[model samples]
Target chain A: MGLEIINTLILLLLVVAALVALRVKDLITASVVFGVYSFLMCLLWAEMGAVDVAFTEATVGAGISTVVLVATIFNLKRKSSD
Target chain B: MKNTSLIPVVLVGFLLFYASTDFPEWGDPQSPASSSPVSSHFIAKTGVDTEVPNMVTAVLADYRGFDTMLETVVVFIAGMAVLAILRNFSRKKPVKRGHEVSVEPDLIVTNTVRLVVPVIQIFSFYVLAHGHVSPGGGFQGGVLMGASFILIALSWDLERALTRFPINRCMVVAALGILLYAGIGVLSMALGGEFLDYAELEKVLPVSREMARYHAMLGVEIGVGFTVTAIMFALYANLSSRGRLEGGL
Candidate 1:
């Protein structure tokens, strides 16, 4: 029962983070929020007992991909035009 | 306009959530996936066949090795595609952005990174080698390893990081990783077994058949680690420098 509540909270945060990432005009902020979303996803995977998947998501999704996205954005405009 | 778009998006989102109600309860023993004969076979015999306590690792590096091998190749290809598109090999100067400020590497950040980089590298190695017993493997370990180099770049500059791991050597390491994976598979085949049949390696190694699979899985993981670590750094280096391999963020 406790686990269910924690899962629900994390899921809610995940949805909020996803919406913020998509809605934000600043690409850098979006990427960082996307990192938060990835970390939340990692947490979700861990809670589901898929530790391997969670570890992968933490490293690849949250860690490396954020840096990669930031690096790419540096070469372009930082703000969303639309 | 955005409000109109939101309606369909919300509808689809709800539809997807409603559809997900059909999925079996988490970890349900009676679920179709859990009750499948293939799952039972793996759960029952993975220990006996590979002598690996971590069934996920055994299944990934041994049973589905071909899929993982191709996945590594896919990573390599993706890195290459990015490089092909973004790498500016010409000697042209990078356009200066108005907001760019040339700043020296901070003492505190560099000092902290100096202290942390080795620990991260060591931990990555532990994750890679110990993945057989734990919840990590090549991809996670390799990403961690690559991030260490990236940390160096972030703390100092791309040149400093590139000095330690140059792009040319990065490519070599990435290719060698793929070669190592395929070589192991071919070696097992040459030993009178089907491709990727790690049990055949027992004739060469002193270990029993089960141990052979275990050790072979380790070798495969190492190959995966090598490719992932190199490509990760390479991707960052190229993307950050816009392929000029010069001054970068």
Candidate 2:
């Protein structure tokens, strides 16, 4: 019961973080927040017992996808007017 | 690109959420994944036939060996694609070194990182070698190994690290790995069984069926590891180069 409560709280936090990311003006911070969102989703997948999918999400989603997106952002001109 | 377009994205997100409603609850023992015919067959036969502790390996290398072989070719193709892209468009001149930056503070950190990097590399090798017996496998180990270089690039400059492990050489090794895997498959076919059938190789070698299967799996796994590591490294190099160019560093 306690574990269930924690999982629900974590999922709620992830949704909130993702919304914040979408609303943020700074593209870089938003990208980082999205990466955090991916990490949390991987944890949720693990909690749901899809270990294989969780593993792929943790590696590809959190690691490779984040790096690629961040690198692409770095190549673009930074602006506060997102 | 507009807020209006995001309506579709929002709808897709909600659709995914709704789809999850039909999924079994977390850790339900009676889930189809746990009780499926394929999983059951693997669990029952893997131990008796393969003598391998890792059931994933038995399924990947024995039951679906053909799929694994083609997956290796896909990885090799990806590596080649990166190499082609880099060769076609990268700047010809070496990136100019700017005015001397302060090295004293960063020196200590770099030295410490350099010390730990080799240990991480060793651990990746251990993961690759023990994949047949453990939870981890070639893809996981290969990424871990590639990540060590990324750390080196972060602590030190990308240029210095690129000097030690040239992207071109990584590409060559990746292609060679695929060739080696295909050679094994062809050898199996020549010995009278269908392609990638390790049981046919048993007639030529003095080893048991289990050992032959293990050997074949190791060959393909090493190929996968090489191809994935090389392609990942290539992607990082290209992305970082683009970053440096746009950032004017």
Candidate 3:
């Protein structure tokens, strides 16, 4: 029962993070929020017992993807279309 | 635009939540994925056939060795693709213009990286070699290993990191890793077994057939580790630098 509540909360946060990442005007902040979304998803997967997948998500999503996205944004003008 | 986007987002989220209700309960031992004969077969026989404690590693590096080999090559190819696209652009511009805009490496970041790098590298190898008993394997270990070099790149400057693991050397190591994997496959074939049949390794090795598969999986994981580490830095160096090989973000 406790696990169910935690899972729902995490899922909610994941949605919120994704929405904020989309809504944000700053590309860099959006990308960082995307990282947060990745992290939360990893946590959810870990909680579900897919430790291998969670590890990959933590490394790729939270670590490398953030770096790549940030670096890609650094080369662009900082403004968002919205 | 924001409101329009929000409608679809909320709709999608709602649908996803609704759909997730159909998924089996968490930790359901009888879930289709875990309850299938294929998984059960692996669980039952992986220990007897390979003598490796970790079923995932045995399945990945032994039963599905060919697939893993190709996956490693794919990583190497991604590094090369990034280099191909970004390298020339960086080279055309003067390198000095890069440093003018780049900040000097902060003392704290550099010091922390210096302290953490050795430990990270050690852990990467442990993850790679210990796949027979742990949750880690080639891909995970490789990513961790690559991240170590990337940490060097991140905390300091790209140049300092590159100096430690140069771009040319990175490519060579990446290619060699895949080669090592294929070489083992070909060796197994030559030893009167099918490709990637690690048990065939017992012909040349002193260990029993079961132990040969166990040790061979370790070698395969290490090869994966080498490729992943090299390409990881290579991708970071290229993408961050826009191929100029200096003053990477």
- For DockQ, candidate 1 versus 2, the one ahead is 1
Better of 1 and 3 by DockQ: 1
Q: Could you give candidate 1's per-residue lDDT for residues A1-82 as a string of tens digits?
A: 8889999999999999999999999989999999999999999999988989999998898559989999989877534331
Q: How far in Å is the alpha carbon of B110 misplaced in model 3?
A: 1.4
lDDT of 3 at B187: 94
For each of the candidates, what fraction of the native contacts does it recover? 0.74, 0.14, 0.44
How far out, in Å, is residue B217 in model 3? 0.7
DockQ of 1: 0.56
lDDT tens per residue, model 2, B67-148:
8778877867765665465444546754433422323337877988889879878877776787788755667667767777
Per residue, candidate 3 scores C-alpha lDDT tens digits across A1-82 of: 8888999999999999988998899889999999999999999988887777787787788558888888877666424321
TM-score of candidate 3 against the unseen true structure: 0.88
Chain A TM-score for model 2, please?
A: 0.83
**Whole-model lDDT values for every prediction:** 0.91, 0.71, 0.85
Candidate 1 error regions (>4 Å): A78-82, B1-15, B93-100
lDDT of 3 by residue, B61-135 (tens): 898888989889899889988887777743355534433377778999889988988998888788777888978
Ranking by DockQ: 1, 3, 2
